[model samples]
Target: MNTQSDIKLTDQLERDLIERELGTQRLGFVNDAKRVIAAVQNVFTRLQAEARKAKVVYANG
Candidate 1:
């Protein structure tokens, strides 16, 4: 039979692991964002095509 102390320790250990994994995931996301920001983009020209965005959300009312 597990005691209360054991249960508490297990809970704390799980939380610690989750926090550590989250830190690594966040670092990976930051690295990806930096790469995207460093990408090349064309300068605006006298004759440029209109930019368009896909309708991301549709409202049914």
Candidate 2:
């Protein structure tokens, strides 16, 4: 039995947690773009390594 107030509180709590995790400084769009790009690159590199280990080949033909 969730009320509107409860829903609002839950949303606020989730937002707070995200802000805390990312930090206020990193929350700005300009400040986080570089971090986001680096994170994506890191993930891509890891996935590429996994593909190599699994012998999943890709050709740019």
Candidate 3:
């Protein structure tokens, strides 16, 4: 009879190790998302500036 009914050492150790691995993967994903957001913002800012300049040219001509 296994007396440790829901508290096996192997199970608990495996869960703890897997949880740490997942946490590290999640941190990498967050860093990647931030880098993508910054790149998109830069593109939009440049487009806006060009549009403004074209608008001024049209108004003058």
Candidate 4:
């Protein structure tokens, strides 16, 4: 019952599905990287604030 065109269509569909899944995985990785970058920025910001406070205390004392 299967023709050549039908086989080609099935192959194309399979390729599309694989590409879509890979795209989804890439998006997930990007989101995770963004979250990690944000966390590191927060840590650096807190450290800078603490250093400023320490400097002020040292200068005043």
lDDT for residue 28 in candidate 3, whole number 0-100: 96
Q: Is candidate 3 or candidate 4 better by TM-score?
A: 4
User: What tens digits encode model 4's per-residue C-alpha lDDT throughout 1-61?
Assistant: 5798899999999999999999999999999999999999999999999999999999998
**Best model per TM-score:** 4
Ranking by lDDT: 4, 3, 2, 1
Q: Write the per-residue lDDT of candidate 3 for residues 1-61, one digit (tens) a residue.
A: 3758556876898999999999999999999999999999999999999999999999998
**Which pairs of residues have clashing backbones in candidate 3?**
none
Mark the regions of model 3 whose C-alpha exceeds 4 Å error after superposition.
1-13
lDDT of each: 0.69, 0.83, 0.93, 0.98
Candidate 2 per-residue lDDT over residues 1-61, each given as its tens digit: 5798899999999999988877866667656898899999999999999988677444432
Question: What ranking of all candidate models by TM-score puts the best one first?
Answer: 4, 3, 1, 2
TM-score of each: 0.56, 0.42, 0.66, 0.91
Task: Name the weakest run of 10 consecutive residues (lDDT summed) in model 2.
Answer: 52-61
Which candidate leads in lDDT? Answer: 4
lDDT string for model 1 (1-61, tens) is: 4798899999999999999999999999999987766552232331232221222222321
TM-score of 2: 0.42
| Model 4 TM-score relative to the real fold | 0.91
What are the per-model C-alpha RMSD values against the true structure? 13.9, 13.1, 3.3, 1.5
State, as a TM-score between 0 and 1, how close model 1 is to the true structure: 0.56
